[model samples]
Target: METRLLEPMESLISAFVLITFLQTALGAQEFYRQPTHESAVQGSSIVLRCIIKNRDGTVQWTHGGFGLGTERNLPGYDRYTMIGNTNSIDVDGNSIEEYSLKIDNLQLIDDTNYTCQVSPGDSDEGIISNMATVTVLVPPSPPILSGKVTIPVTLEKPTNVTCDALNGKPKAQITWKKDDVRIMENTYELTTTQPDGKRVDTRGIVTITAQPSDAGKKIECGAWNMALKEGEPLWTQATLDVQYAPKLTLTHSNPDRTIREVDEVKFTCSGEANPFQITWRWYRNGELQADVNGYQYTIPRITRDFHGQIIRCEAENSVGTTAVEHSLNILYGPKFKGDPAHVSVDQGERAELVCEAEGNPTAEITWRRQNKYSVLHTGSIYVIPSVREGMFGVYTCTATVLGFHEISRDIYVTENGPPQITSDATQYASIGDRAMIQCLSISSPKPIFVWSRNSQPIDYASSGRFSAPEEGLPFGGKSSLQILDVQEEDFGIYNCTVINTKGSATLMIKLEKSEEVQMAVIIGSAVGGVAVIFIIVIACIIYYKCRHSDNESYAETDSNTEIKKRDKNESPSEMTKSTLMDQWRQDYNYRYSAEFDDVDAKVGNTSGQYVCYDTERYGTMPTNHTNGHLYGEGVDDLGPLNRFENSYSTGYIPSTFRSPSRTDFTSGRVSANELASGRTSVNDFTSGRVSATDFTSGRVSTTDFSGRASADLVEPFRLPTADNTTSKLATNV
Candidate 1:
């Protein structure tokens, strides 16, 4: 075998070896390149390269010993060309020449043996290059289905199917599949060549052992070749005709109808079977029942617990077993909807309670008072047409089904009481953010909600930015007024009233700008604060500078003393208005700056200086700035003042208290608009918080107001001490 292979190789190359010896002897020329074996897909192009060096010779091409004349384009073959590189490349002072064959639009017929013949120096002796065999790839045809088109099998038996792909240049790769899934197990392939000895064919066979579960499924064979489109193969398919055991379907006597307690229901298992005899089995919720081999099972007295059960029936034959299930949604006993209710209404108004239940059979309802045997009312709703004082007690509502259990819910009746609020009285949101003022109150019989702003009723039902929704709570009434988009006009006091059959209670809820706005204001104030402080410092310095000169002119000499003496007869009511600050500016400065509250002004150490406390901190204060008497509430927790042994004036009482501005006692803080609201009184300074005590101009409480001190403006003391002096404050109060 080896000698036979070497004989062919030696014969093809014998001429080349002889030419090499002759060329060495003559010292004439050499072969630089030789044609190489190649494979090309049909319909593409290919090149068989040949080159020679120092060639003073002619080159010719051959196909399987047939001569092909050396021409630019081959004779009789349009796709064949004998091309040469006439412009030779120099190699070590020797020119290298190329005489290569180029083939385009290749076909299977082009696959053959090729050779390049070179004759050196016009000698008759020819030198044959090594033989180069070319292969043209041809794709196989689409696969053909054969042998069982529909393979039939059962659990106990198996079957086979075959597919073939014929006439491929290179043998095709055959693959087996079942229902699009590649089947490798029990699948085999065979390959064979056609008589022509060029093209081959392949066949794939796959075995099927299908169960009842896989009946009516498809099987397939795929043929793949490198010459075909990428990732796509030709396919042939078959289906499975599987024979198995009986298939069962279950049906109940009550189809789409309610089966109540004590009602009879029968379930039947029916199916088609391959075998003559079929064994039946029944299971309830996966637990096998005692009776087997019965096609129908009957439940004579089905109970409520039987509802929502899965009853399955199985049919078995010699081949296999199949099962089906029926789910029971039988309606049964009655059950109450919610827990016992406690309803309350106002005296003499109709009171009612609804008792709801669900059951297959309609439930009967009745109402009765506790410890009283008589049935009060029937039906789902128990109504008390007119409830009086004595009617406030517990009533029982009973729901019953004809043959099942009876359920009861209690209704505790009571007269509604006055509503009391429990939610926050102040709600805040920024501009363009939602603001909800919720008023949650506790009373009996759900209450109604009413909203008002600045003594005017607010109608939330009208399609507007403000909306109030109705709410009903158990023994309470809850309501919220939603400000959809908070604007400048939205921030204010909102009166929320919770009313029922009982008395109504109104809560004062203030919706103001959120803390974000305060933070922005603080930042803005801080930015301008430095410049304002510089200006004030400069003004104070200049005032002191001028005051020093003025003191020299009006120093308590004999002439100034006589002027003071002239004013000595001026009574305590004698007053002089400010020269610089108009009433508005004075009021604005008092509200915003509140310099009297400046604990930093501790010259602050002394007691008699009345406190101007922050209402936000203390929670309450007097809005009435009349008579310049400051009243504060909950002042027992004064911080820095506690460090001093100060006696608060418990004696002072505000007379003729009035709020000239809308900033009343209820809204203790000053609004931005109120600062420039043109509201100003000469001595209208706000003290601290005041109670509802309307002092009828008599002597007020002698008890000294502790932290209630915001220093009085009219410091008309008998001894004529300064503004912050303890003795002067005590005397003036």
Candidate 2:
């Protein structure tokens, strides 16, 4: 079949018409119906309906993607009974065209999309209905949450927590909070299942074990669901408190009472309390030591200064306080003194007694006499009526204070008298001889005598041959004592003691012996005898040996003198025989007598003419009157011959001379004529000569030898005038 092609617009219009025509020819029509979109809660009812445009068609309904017909109905539509047509509708009023649906007890799952369809005749295809989507909308009332209705209900016991909520759209979840934290499930019991088939929200009861910390805490319950706009909450709170009391105790502070200077004693007060503070205080001598909080008190070291002080310790807390006390007692020792206990005083004189004592609190003093009489009290001085022997015993002074007592030294009083002593021998005596010392002390009442040998007292019985004189020997109006035969043992101090009613006195006796006076007589006699014998022997030997030698040298000197005399033309008259003789005598006397005898004799003969004569007769002779005249011209007429005679008479005579007449001047006195003439007399010549017989007999002879010419004599008799008139005359001749 050849068909004509149509234009694009015509073809589109034709296709539309054909489709529409086909729809009309097939007897298919769309049902234009409004689905009754009614919303219900989880446990409410709902209904949906369809409206048909064609009168002769079949109608159907569906939910979500599942078909909905009479055999398989929609959810919650099981009990639906259709009230409209089941096939094509009659135009005028047949019961075959209208379509409708019903649902009861809707749930959350029941809300969905619905569809309605229509078929016009039996042999025609059905038509797709216009999409009149009927959506199930719910009006956000208070939610009946599923878990709240059918879920488990849980609660903790003894906790006042409400399992309820408010102001939620669908439903809100509810829970309990402790310390702002969720409670554990294990702490609560729960119940589930509701009376209706729909699920309900559950509310849990919160159980709490209250503690001190649980006071003033908050508990809560709430509900929520997906349909609710916000969660609903219920809240509650309470306050907690606890009560208690405190306990107390005490302890003492100081254990040792011996406190140092400025030392503190501490007392401690302690206790256990909930809300209280502790305090401390102290008391001393019933008075407060300080204000409160004074746990310690200090006391300086006590002296006599602080003897009766009292101290205490106190302990306290907020509740109350108590006290303990102690006392201080200082101890001191005793002291005593006495000055000049023993003193000396004259008879019938007054004496003093001094006593003192030192003690704590000033000791009380008392004085008593030796005779038990009270003398003084509480002072340092005591006096006696009269110082006598009866008052010579110990006087005691006692001091008592503060239950302590002390006694002073004993005081003794005495009187004074004269010293008594005597001597059996004089003050001077010979050495190695016996002497005596006697001593006696006389006091007013006849004091007792004590004898001392040296410094120590002597026992008369033990000392051999020592004797003491009778006591109370009256002499010179005083008593005396004599000690006999005192030896060197009595040389040292000897003391005499005397006692009387008044007092006592002491005296010392000393003795000494002389040595020089005893030896004077014996020394003088012995010295005189020895000297006389020594001189006699010396003179005898000198005369015997030197007599001849002296004569020969004299003769040789004369001869040599003549030779020298001729050379000088000097005369023999110028030579002096007396000078020669004196020289010879000095040499002989010194050599012989000084060597043999230890005696010295000084010659006082200044004329140098004195001869040492063995016999006293020769010693007085004028041997060289003519030589004296020559050499001693114009000199004094008196010669050594006169001096020799005077010395012999004065006991300077040699031992060889024994007759008493030897002491007399045997030389004849110069006559007045010889004095006037200045010449030797005939008697002087006789006195100058000595006999051989006298020498041989070892005695000085008094025989006259005036006419005898001996070889020993020089011959010339050239006498010079006393005035040197002859020397002038010879020079002139």
Candidate 3:
């Protein structure tokens, strides 16, 4: 506007200056500019556009503000030119500017502000212009997790929830929750850089524990970038499930059972929870009875009361426990009764009494004998013998059942009457005769008979002939006393005692001799024969004195001589008679010779008298010759002699003599000298010349010469021998 200071060098300088000004203004517009975006994802390509504003101007490019042009203007700007476009200008390089800035990849420091400008002249005239700011931007991508999203969660267990955003522009924010409740907050973590130059975004772990109530509950994991909004949530959920089983138990009231007497009963119990199997057991006393799978129990026929009884049941499964119980009261009764009480025995004997009883347990039997001896037994019969008065007392048989009950009975034994006695002999007998005494008894009870003599029991052979018929018996006979020849020794009382239910008896006897009267007659006749012979001798002496009186003295001497001679002859006969008479007197002691003082009166005359006189009147003769002659004779003649001699010859005679006269005559007063010297021959006596003188000769006179002989004194006679006059005399006497 002032047109100021134009010179020759001014006028020419003025036109040059105007042209310099136009060139300066045009070159100032060709500088490079920085991009607007600063940051980029690590592996992505980026474009950094550095814009230049001068069109129709030479342009150059460089890094970190280094120039690519010199002071001298050159065509090297073609290397920095836009395609098909030379120097053309637009404001701030909106159009037709040299836009020559470029970047193949972006980095963090590339975010700084950059300037683009141009230089007007050579050497010291270059300048720079205003810069454009670049800022790199990145958006959030889907996050990835390292561990499981739907996790198996347990109570009281610590767990980690991880969210990794690979190569994220800004690190991500992570959280954890359970059922939408917040558990942990944004705990962002930066992981180490990747090989592709990108970074990892890591989140913190969420620690939590679950309880029993937390079983089957949900737990959650959540992630956010704020770059990724809430509507599209980064949260994951898992359900928690828990598993277990329950426990079981069982119970009972009575564990053991005992019973007394008669009562009723029941049993029961319960079981605990589980998948349980149960069983029940019942016991009587201490013994096991029944087992069942159910709870209720009952026992019928309960006869005994259960004393302190118990019953129990049990339940069991995978787990364990126990429960309460139920019990009962029971009773029972005694089982059996006793058998009958009795005794068995033979008809007339004693026996035993046995009592028996039986029960659940065996019963006891008590036996009492006569209320005295006592015995006990389980079961048996009692026995005894001889049913007598002693066995007649009380016998009790009692039985006790179960030691609690009893029954008894009384028994008695009885027998019949006493025994009897029978004998075989009459009431009386002579001494030395046989007699029998026997005992026979009859009773219901058999008797024992004891046979005794003189109060002492008799042995079988004590009596010469005594014997026992058989052993003692009831109907059978017993001992017998056979007194063979009863004597005064056997005269004592005899007893056959029958000992039985009844009592005893005896028989008495006396023994004596027969023929006392016959003995007396024999004594009288012997004394009478001596007296008659004496009378005859005295009478003959008187008659001779009367006839010789003239030679009185001679007559007296002669008569005296005759008397002496007669005395001599008669004395032998008289002495024999006297000896026999004395012997009879000594043996019998009976007074009978006084009645036979008359000899003729005792033996009267008969023709038999002469036979009696020769033998009987010569009683003092020797008998030695007679025995010798008789022994030599025939036995027929000896028979009558032996019979007659033995009949009257009391065996006191010597064996050498044949007659009793030998004993009587040898003791006679007759001298042996007189018998030898005297001569008294009276012969021719065998002729049939019957004269009074012959009949009445010598000492032969009788009480009546023809009177018959006494029937008691006379007996038939025979001569034993011619020399046997002595024995014949003995018989006649």
Could you say which candidate leads in TM-score? 1
lDDT of each: 0.60, 0.42, 0.40
Q: What's the CA error at residue 477 for candidate 3, in Å? A: 99
The lDDT-based order of candidates, best leading, equals 1, 2, 3
Candidates 1 and 2 compared by TM-score, better number = 1
Candidate 1 regions with alpha-carbon error over 4 angstroms: 1-245, 249-323, 329-333, 340-352, 359-362, 383-393, 402-405, 412-418, 422-440, 444-472, 477-504, 507-733
TM-score (all chains, Cα) for each model: 0.31, 0.19, 0.24
Give the per-residue lDDT digits (tens) of candidate 2, residues 1-733.
2254545668899998896775565454445565654544455556667666554555567667666664324345565544565565465433335567666666545556666655446545566554444323232223232223222111211333335433232334555555577776534323343343234435445544445555444443444454433454444332222212234343434454543223344444444532344355555556775554454454434454334565555554332344555564444434675333444455457877777766555677777653355554447677766754344334567667665445454443433433322221223334455544444232223345666756777677876655555443111112233335545654545565545554455555445443464467888878996996688568545643543343344443353532321232122121234433433334434432313221111121211111223221221211121221101111212243433344332222232322223222333322122211224332343343322233123122122111122213222221111121111111100
lDDT of 3 by residue, 454-492 (tens): 677877765556765644221223454566776766664
| Local lDDT at 142 for model 3 | 53
At residue 713, give the lDDT of candidate 2. Answer: 28
Worst 10 residues of 1 by lDDT: 598-607
Off by over 4 Å in 2: 1-28, 70-77, 85-96, 119-125, 129-733
